[model samples]
Target: MSETVPTPPSPTTRRQLLARTGAAGIGIAFSGALSELFTGTAAAGNLGHGGYGPLVPDPDGLLDLPKGFRYRVLSREGDPLRSGEGPVPSNHDGMAAFAGRHGRVHLVRNHENRATGRVPVPVIEGLTYDPEGKGGCTALTLDHRGSVLSERVAIAGTAVNCAGGPTPWDTWLTCEETEDKAGTNGYTKDHGFIFEVDGADPRRTGAVPLTAMGRFQHEAIAVDPKRGVVYETEDAFDRPFGLFYRFLPRKPLGGTGSLRAGGRLQAMRVPGVPDLSSIRETGARFDGIEWVDVPDPLAAGTPIRFQDFGPRGITHAQKLEGCYWGGRSVYFVSSYARSSEGSAGDHYGQIWRYDPDRRRLTLVIVFGPDTDVRLPGESPDNICLAPGGGLMVCEDGGGAQHVYGVTRRGEVYAVARNRQNVGTPEDPEWGEFAGVAFSPDGDTMYVNCYAPGTTFAVTGPWRG
Candidate 1:
């Protein structure tokens, strides 16, 4: 049931990463970002000294970052889009940056809304899936100076567009975090599916759901470029939790529309381990992983997690959130687990690395229950490899939200703080940070504030 996989001898080791990145810290190295974070470097400690120094308070009372760093509001909920269709939607969750033509960067952002929001995604013709569904994605084109050139509705009429992954061919997979079906909660069509959104060109981002990818409380996904296999995570926490999934696309990497051809949806299973939260120790590994086919990927009746998976049931995890591909392995996150919530175990947070080549899943980082709620070590959501090295984790826990950075030594440092107080002066409301990603060139960092729905472009001397 429990095993320790031998660490591969490579630059992935913590000692090697420290040597490469240097103990004092250098500039951001995009190539070794993920390797530095997972390799022994994610031991969970607040090294308040090394990361870009201390965060300087913002005069505008919006976002606080280190000295010399500044942020600009790129978009906000109710802001009018360039298409003249409607204003921006609310709850900007997961986002990805891509290279664009003529020295521009395209950003595909998810709007995590449901039936009602402050500003709903406009049900535009050709882009809307269901007229009743109000969650979708927006595409923004930024110039070299990180200025928004144009903004348009990429996909619309979806529900709970939570977090999704970017494709190898420069596309974004926007996922619906809800399992609402027709006649439920005013949904005109069945929800809970992945829709491909093209950041560069909104015309290509048809609001068609990839039904073959399984229908459940979809959270996030990571596509393996080598095998053309897509790794997905379910965030259902009602009773049975959620299962880790993989979608084998029939046409691999053909282009943006390749996944529409249909594929096989399967769930992961570990011989003896049923719930992933049961594993507590860091560096814990499970080998010989198995995949079981889901009889109903559409989940027209029973949800995927409750469905039978034979004698050996599928493995499930609590609050499986952020997912991304790094260093030939797929990294997924369990935001937090609590026994009172029906989880097998309890933890502040955990990051797991799954190696397809070795067929192994290792717990690289584990946040203890005693982790400071105000710190960056707990409730990590919407993670991405920072262009400046290490991992950029968005804190979704209690108190003031922040975008924290984990160095190559597993040391946690505050990268940016959410200073926006949405509530009154007495009881201030801080929104959780989401969609933390860097530009392809690594010059600018893009993140979102979930509550008021604001996107910020952060830039500074990242070569600390």
Candidate 2:
């Protein structure tokens, strides 16, 4: 199979696209009318203070942030929940915040637990999908002051609940990053699917997997509000990398439970680009992109990436992690790639923005191999567009872990650092940051520490 690489867009056309989309070169596009979020925000290069200034060491030795910022521990592993079911689960990963009644905050959090963990999501009657599966989601209700009012099990009986995305109709899509079958791992049913959780009403969240969305090593997803199309990422790091997918649902914007109706899953095909990691240029653009229908979304035997796509094979990327919908484009992350791992090239990370309107994919940001491991631009995992503009990226790399901020100009700065020492004082260990989100009013930020399984509500003077 072969594909012809199209010529790059002209400079004038690139400039016009950027101007029309308000894409600030950093892959930062105004999400709808969110341009006001960056009104007075300083450019990444011009910020002598480095975004919000230097991070001040925390007295609690947990999370360090800029001066004037404060964080509250909303929930932790083994912490008893208000629902009286059991303790909070471990390995907090992807999360989303929603508006709650009476100015409260509703958060749906994922517990990325596999077969075993420090604490597993307790199985409830209607919420339990498989009694043996040890991963699921939890819902928390917090007051406006960042105080946890209630916490309960949203869904249970799922495996490897990794990163997921929020829906347009106010629901959380929790994905299982596993392909374990029922009989292989002491299971009863097939795994590898996406489940919808209702943060507002836990009872309404029946633990049902959207099978039509495809079954593979699922990662994060981005939902296009205009068309109700779901763009998903797969984290399969084997010989052949995972393919980016988009599901065209039978019912668009049909609110909750609509996705369960079914959809057609398709893989992205970027002409001559077989491996995305080979494209190192920051502004490299690929036009005339196409989507190939997956032979089998269920993956009854062969995985989607391994499945045949005819003469032109599907394009794949290494470590396709975070995904989010911004303006008219869908931004997805490739955490890192290595030649030793069968990649075409090597790089610290790359962020690609796909414009559905133009059927174009642009490499907006590329973290070179020389990026400082201690810095913010290395191996970005879960990501969310900040309410105050720019982006909040969770680091999942070697050395120190931090929640970094990226401006429209592509400048990187530290927002919060994980200082919690889970190991001995002599050999300290830090957990990666995951599930970075913001409240509806944009006053509070919610993030999680994947290790000790801690959720934090951070408040401070956010840049407007």
Candidate 3:
């Protein structure tokens, strides 16, 4: 199978990628040469000292950031829980940051919970896989000036968990978003999968699922630590849309990174784009890409992206959620698209970019259903890859919940907002920003609010 032919985007890089991609089709373009090369200058009058400049408004009103930045909530769902077990476990959502013991900084987080009694933890029997499934993962630690120093639970039960990724042998793949199964809705076991969480012994972590990594509904995951490949993401919000996976890993990661020693679960095909909901424009490229095998990566009820993998074609992405792996390519996120939800129509967010050395798959940023334009979030779900370079998104749509930051010349900056406010006086600060990581010496910048779950860090000056 060597018909290799993928080298053609060089008329000066396709005119600098058509002068930084934007405006291809699908009724909504944003104008001004794609909003001044990708949504920068959108709203945010003053506060740019590189970034983190004009936010300061949090007198304990939750988070606002900017001005020497300064956050550090560390952990807080129900609070307490410093390994004494109990409490500190709510929605939280995707997170990752490693390196601890002396230098400190472990993180790990992710609760997202999918029901079944709501919240409760302390079931570390043999590192639980589904005590009844309320979701799991905690491990805090911190300190190197970020504060906090203990908060445990690591892996347990496992259900909605949500976004995860950070493992070039450091561990923390989390996922689960929900395929439910097992005794139906009451769940005895059999939730959408992908579990591995150790981050250097987060309570001996091990609920093992990796079920060949497929299940559907999983959300975020991105790890190509030089070809160990794992890129998953699927929020699937209705009408057959949600795919973009890639597991590969039969054996390539040497030591104790452990992908459970099972792999091969592809899905991602843009060949001639049959019906990926018509590829909702924005920069819309989709060069070549191909990958199809996925008979049933533990589907149990069928949903390997609607499986059929025969002539090899599969494409979905409407709510593919977050995914990140910087430069060498892999930066997914298709958070919104709506033909009333069946997609291929009313998009509100996009951002693709795959490129594994020309296998191609581009669609760099799109968001049409104006939230008052100039880019300030609409549904851009959890993503992270901005140690000053590009992407940082996280704003599950709806209002006053930012954490944006696009730049790599694509502009868009509003970094951190969420003024956390729940009920009473009729709700307003609608918390959304979930797990926006960056702290392996990239200073500090952990996120997460997802409904009173909290866990900040922030720091200052980061622009690249």
Candidate 4:
């Protein structure tokens, strides 16, 4: 790639950017030892800290948490649980951390599958799903040392258990991002909705589905403390374009974690046409502050469609997937374009930010077809804020994808190349480590993915 990413007012070709070497200009310099290891396989099987701290559970060994943090293999892809009450499903998506009994921690992890009746033989009540993404979620409890105390099946019969956010009251807001029938969706009867998982006490109750979050193709979950509103992203751009929304619980949060009997769901609308100039024009900028009220969020033809960023809008939108809150901002990413529809503005990928203070949204990083000479345009998937700040984008796009980072000043660098050492263009698994998380202290990091389906931890001093 290019040595120094153009600061401004300069048109650079993709080739120049991909020509960058061992250590391109991303601020600090790489040591001689570190430089040689940058593009090699040795680092893949070892701890990689990139521009931050060390990665725990060295790739050479098994999954083990670093010193300060702990981990437990709650459930594996093909593992059976709960006396075979149900078969363990695959594709674990979103997860959250909460305070358990006497200071222990609890996690409500999601499984993304649309299969049904494919249960792994020998049924387990609260431990299995329809296997075909028929909508299911799980809960696991662990102590401070990373030892899993117990595991249980929360709720079954939900599809595409995509990513979700944690609520203020120590509960996970899991979302079913896909329609139940897959044919005719966008209604309450189907699978599109957000539910709550109470991790404190099992005696408190099992899984309780919350339908109040709406029935559109759900994605990430975010909460706005300023207004006691829970923000959500929609991957459902059937006709009018996907939407962003907020749910105001009708009853206080102490309710029975049921969406059907809860608050109101409202879609978001930017006040005035948001000025995306900060990204497009480079200089002809505006704060990008805009707001839209749902008005009648429950009505299918409600006025929520006004939120799309367009002359009203454009072709099918970039399906927004992951989202989280940090430093007073709610961040999210848009997946690539649909093949059915042609040139999606030839967009590689972009990350957008929403500021609660100014009540606006802005597109930040634009990783185009110049990411790497090995393979261009890798689909950027979910993302998490780094402990040292910035973002760790999980690249799911094809060939030679890496977990890359972007600074507020517009600098980008690869933290670790996810491609294994096997060496081959047809590498069956180039990048599967999609989900990334940090310990409470932000000193340790963990990552997991679908291919071969494994989780990793890396520990060390990564902050500048």
Best by lDDT: 2
Residue 25 in candidate 1, Cα distance off native in Å: 26
TM-score of candidate 3 relative to the true fold: 0.35
For model 2, give the 10-residue run with minimal summed lDDT: 1-10
Cα RMSDs, all models: 8.8, 8.9, 18.3, 9.0
Q: Write the per-residue lDDT of candidate 2 for residues 333-405, one digit (tens) a residue.
A: 8987877678898876788889899999988777632123344556778888776557788987654578988
TM per model?
0.89, 0.90, 0.35, 0.70
lDDT of 4 by residue, 381-444 (tens): 6677665555666666544445665544433455554434323433232424455666555554
In candidate 3, what are the lDDT values of residues 1-464, reduced to their tens digit?
A: 00011121222132223223432322223211122122222322232433454567889888887677778777778877977878887878788888776788888888877665356555787778877777788888777877777788888887777787887777788887777788867778788888888856754546878787777688788887788788898876565777888889888585454577887888877776754546665566666688877888888767777778766457675667788776477777776666644565666677677778888776667754333322354567787765544457786754356787654434456777877766443433355778888887777888888787888888876644
Model 2 steric clash pairs: none
lDDT of 3 at 421: 62
Q: Compared with the true structure, what per-residue lDDT tens digits does model 1 show for residues 216-332?
A: 888899989899899999988567998899999999786867999998999999879989999887777889999899989999889999999997778888889999988689989
Ranking by TM-score: 2, 1, 4, 3
Candidate ordering by lDDT (highest first): 2, 1, 3, 4
Candidate 2, residue 386: lDDT: 72
